[model samples]
Target: MTLKICVAQLNYCVGDMPGNAQKIIDAARAAYADGARLLVTPELAICGYAAEDLFLRASFIEACDDAVNRVARELAGLKGLTVIVGTPTHGNTGRGDEAAGGLRTKSMAVQQRHNAARVLREGEVIATYAKRELPNYQVFDERRYFTPGQGICVFEAGEGESAVRVGLLICEDAWFEEPARLTKEAGAELLVVINASPFHVGKGNEREVMMQNRVRATGLPLIYAHLVGGQDEIVFEGRSFALQADATLAGRAPGFKENMFQAQVERAQAAIKIIATTEPERGDDAELWDALVLGVRDYLGKNGFPGAILGLSGGIDSALVLALAVDALGADKVRTVMMPSPYTADISWIDAREMAHRLQVRYDEISIVPEFDAFKASLAGEFKGLPEDTTEENIQARIRGVFLMALSNKFGSIVLTTGNKSEMATGYCTLYGDMAGGFAVIKDLLKT
Candidate 1:
């Protein structure tokens, strides 16, 4: 018997409980319409991934629970369909006081939170699996917000003849061998892992290799459903995929985009097989480019920004920023300004104007020489003994910043800073001069 499954690789915003639940409901309905018996959404799809301090508040946790219930109710009409949703839920604190008569009292329960994946069927949650492993390194802080859960979660899908036992796991649980081993020992035929792992160079390939190891170890087919979007400085590349029990690639979704990835699993007696269409692999450079573009697009679009404005220098840094902004927001929505000081070269002006013209964005030049002279004149008394130094050069940059910010305020567009990681690390860029923008598009990238 064959079972069809759909992975919802979607973008979710943090703290948007109602909006996030609606998106999940919509995805579930669509997946059911596509004939999928099982639907898997990414980690924390209910209240969005990593709600941070919001998770500490009882009201926020209550809202998340309500949203999960709403999703379950909203998806009840889709008969014969089972959905797995990631969320945060209260758990046992595992501590209790002793009674006065030397009798042990009941354990204090539901005082802590757990990163959970819940199974919803017929408008009710049938089962839930809490994440056992909590990662604390790098960008992950699961240990800080949640308590670890124990044991395995193996649940049945479909009817007796074609039924498959699926083991559920959150993001970090799949990295270790014991979870899958214990799950398979509990009579699970397949494993489904939901995640909201952030993007880094070559992180996609690393995930594929790790999942393959788990499949080989457990001899159970695996499916990875990942989140996609830009949140603050981090970005999630979807690339949801599946692996057969033999560790071969079964299917893959495109990276840096939202997709409803599909796969079919055939269960015959004790044997199981996975069949899916594999998406072609992308090069590192291509993947990086798409990450930047998606990051910019989602960051601006989700934040309700109409357009972007950035200082356009003739150098490669600002030029690359302009290209990305255009690709993300289009040329019509982007505007550029060239603020040249008295020390600016004629070639810089020529190059800046030519590039803006080729891109077909609004470009204007505002000379900062007058502002530079005024600053010098005003500070002459304070620096009578001191010779002319880097302070004067910084004034030029500050003058340019004033123009860009003024333009940004007059219009509703956000200022996209063009400073790269190298300049930021070495303090080559001025604080209020080059770093005055609302968003830093290339702040994490180094100059090559």
Candidate 2:
């Protein structure tokens, strides 16, 4: 028996349930037309992952449930095809009253919300598996919103000889060995894990290694479906994959790109086999570049930013950020302002203007000498005989900040802060000066 599975690696906007559900339905139709029996999407594909405080809103959860139900209803006629859509569903446990009246179900409380994946088949939810592990470390705060799921979800898709028992895991659930081990013990021939994992350098390789370990430990073939998009500060690199029990890379989707990756899992007389396997080219620098580009593009597009503005210093940090911003938002949408202080060299100004011209973006030169002098003179009476130091340097940076922010306010452009890890770690950057922006391009990035 051979079962075709489609992995829908998509970018979802947070709080946009109707839009997200429409995407899921479109993908389901495409997958079914392509002869796929099962379709899997990234975790929280219905309401977007890492929704933060939105999970607390009763109306938000209600809307998500309604959207997921709409998806199930829209794709119900596709009989025999099972779709596992990720969402936040009200858990059946806990002893709290509904957060709001008539918002959610009468029995379930809003505070019992679980990070879950719903198995939809024929206009109904057959089963659901909540994320058992809630990561609460750096850059992850799932423990604040979601309750750990109890038990595993293993169901048989299709009937008779063509049937395959599939188990579901959500993001952090796949990290620990318990969920996979329990699912495999519960007679799941293949595992489908949905994730919204954020990207860092070499994170893809690390994920592959971890999946290999799980495959070897559980002795069950697995399909990992990860989201592709940037939500705020996090970027999900969608390198969804499938692996054999022997830790063989059977199928893989490209990283940092939205794709509908398909694979055929056939149950042979002896064991299950992967009939289709496609591995995309891999490079560390190329992957990093893609991650940065996608991060900026999605963050701006989803947040409704018309364009971007950054202060170009002619230094390496701002230079790289300028290039990335241009690449992500296009030259026409990116604006650069070069603010020169008294200590700024002529070559710095030349380099900044030349780069802006080469990029073909809107460029302006604003001299901060006036503002710097005004600040120094205003404070001169207070420290009459004090020698100048970093305070003056910080004043210069603040003047630049004011100029950029004024432009941002007038034009509705987002300010892209450019400060490398070294400057941030050594406290070389000003709090409201260089760090004054709506977003940081390389906050976690190293100076190397």
Candidate 3:
């Protein structure tokens, strides 16, 4: 017999409990309608990943719990449909005999938060798997919010011949050998890992390789459901995937986009097989481009910004920022101002205007020469004998900044800063000048 599983690669906004819960419920119903017996959502899909300080609040945890219950109740009517939803829960497991019943029991005294996944079926939570590994390095701060959970979660899906024993693991759990090893030892036939892993150039491939290692070690087919969309500065690329027991690529969803990725598993007495399409791998450039676009789109779109405005200097930094802005938020929503200084060449504004015309965005020229002259006149007495240095150059930049910010305040558009990583790291860019903006599109990228 064969069992179909669907991975919901969804974009969830942090702290949007109601919206996030609705997304999960909608995806569950759709996946159930699509003949998927099992559905898996990304980590913290109910409240969004890495909620930061929100996790520390008891009300936040309660809201997440309520959302999870809502999803379970909403999907209860879809009989035989099992959904594994990631959420943060307040509970601790009590010691119990695994052979008699389940491994988890509610402890009323302890109120520690756990990064957990719940198995929902027939309007009830059948099992819960708390993430064993809480990633602490780099972008992750899971250690600060959640208490590590012990024990393995292996539940049966379907019935009779088609039934498969599936193990549960959160993002960091699958990265370690112990978690998968214990789950396998607990009589699990398959592994489903839900994640909210942030995007970095080659992070997609890195995840697949790591999951493949887990597959090889345990001889169990695995499915990875990842979150997509930008949250603050971090972006989650949802290239959710599945792999065969032999470490073969069974299937993969697209990156930087939401998708219902399905994998059909055929269960036999001897072995289980996973059947799905393997999407073509994207190049590094394509991945990076998509990350930038999604980052900008979600940052503005989620935050309720009407559009973007940038000071187009006609240089590579501003030029790139303009292109990204236009691509992210259509040309009509993006506006560019060519703010030229006294030292600016004719080619600078000329090139800037030409590029803006090509992109068909609202383009305007506002020379900073007058403002620069005023600033010099004001500082003339203070710097009577001081030789000209970066201060003069910075004054021009700050003047341009004032113009862009004024337009931003007037039109309700966010200013997209164009400073690259190198300049920001070396303190080369003006603080109130070049750094005046709502978002930094290329803050992480180097000048080169």
Candidate 4:
């Protein structure tokens, strides 16, 4: 018998309870229509990942709890379909023991919150799995927010003769062997891992290698459902995939796209095998470009930014940022402003205008020479004959920044800064000048 699993690679907005719940319901409906027995969404799909300080509020957690139940209720009565959603949940182990027909032997203690996965079926939360490993790495601060979970959640999927034991694991849980091995030891023939892992260059390749290692070690077919969106600084590229127990590639969804990918797994001789499916191919540059586009689009769209405004210098960084903004939000929604300083070449304005025209976005010209002169004249009295250096150069950049910010204030447009990694790393960029924007388009990108 074959079991069809749906991996929902979706973009969810942070703190938007109704919208995120509706997204989950819609995805569940589509997956159900496709004959999927189980639908797996990314980690923290309900409330979005890296919620940061919002997790600290009880009201926020309550809203998330209500949203989780709402999704369960909405997805109820769908025959033979189970949806697994990620959320920040209270780790009331005492209540869980009581629900299991045992008296609450433990005393009342401090509140414990967990990064958890909920298994929903028949309009109810059947089982819940808390992430055992709390990653405290570079960008992750899970240790500060959530307490580590203790046990594994292994439940059954499908019914009758086609039923298979499925296990749940959160993002960092799969990195260690204990969680996967524990689930496998508990009779889980299939492992389903949900993740909101942030994207760095070559991260997808690293994920593939990790998945292969886990499959080889556990001898259980695995399904990976990853988030696909940008949340502030991090971008989650959805490369949802499945691997056979023997570590063979099965099916893979494309990166940087919202998809309800279906993986068909069948029971083989003493092991489960994920049937090989079509894997979409994309070049490295294509993948990187898409990541930027998706990141810009999600950051703007989800945050309710009407459009975007950026300083379109003739330099490669600003030009690339303009192209990315146009591609992500469409040309009509993007606006470019050329704030030419006294030092700015005439050819700079020409290039900026030509690129804006080619892209067909709204273009405006604002000369910052007057502002630069004003700033310099005002500060000359205090300078006391000190020779001008980068102070003058920064004044020009700050003038451009002030004009771009003024445009942003006049129109409800997000200011996208065009600072690449190379300039930022060596402190070659201005802080209050070029860096004064709502979003940094390519902060992580190298010059090369």
lDDT by residue for model 1 over 1-448, one digit each (tens)? 8888999899988999899899889988988888888999999988787788888887888888899999999988888788998898885544444444544444544478888888998798999888999999988888889889897899887655667899998888999999989998999999999998999999999999999999988888999999999887889999999998899998999998889999988986688888888889898888888899988998898888999999987989899999999998899999999999877888889989988999999999888888888898999999999987788878888888888999989998999999999999999999789888899999999988
lDDT of each: 0.88, 0.88, 0.90, 0.88
Model 1 residue 360 lDDT? Answer: 99
Q: Write the residue-wise lDDT of candidate 2 on 14-129 in tens digits.
A: 89999999999999999999899889999999999789999988799899999999999999899898999999987444344445653555456335888998999989999988
TM-score computed on alpha carbons, candidate 2: 0.93
Best-to-worst TM-score order: 1, 3, 4, 2
Q: Say which candidate scores most in lDDT.
A: 3
Q: Report the C-alpha displacement of residue 14, candidate 4, in angstroms.
A: 1.2
Off by over 4 Å in 3: 92-110
Each candidate's clash count: 0, 0, 0, 0
| Candidate 2 off by > 4 Å | 92-111
For 88-173, candidate 4 gives per-residue lDDT tens digits of 99855444454435656456335788899899997989999999999998889999999899989999988776688998999898
lDDT of 3 at 138: 96
Where does candidate 2 clash, by residue pair?
none
TM-score of 4: 0.93
TM-score between model 1 and native: 0.95
| Root-mean-square deviation of candidate 4 | 3.2
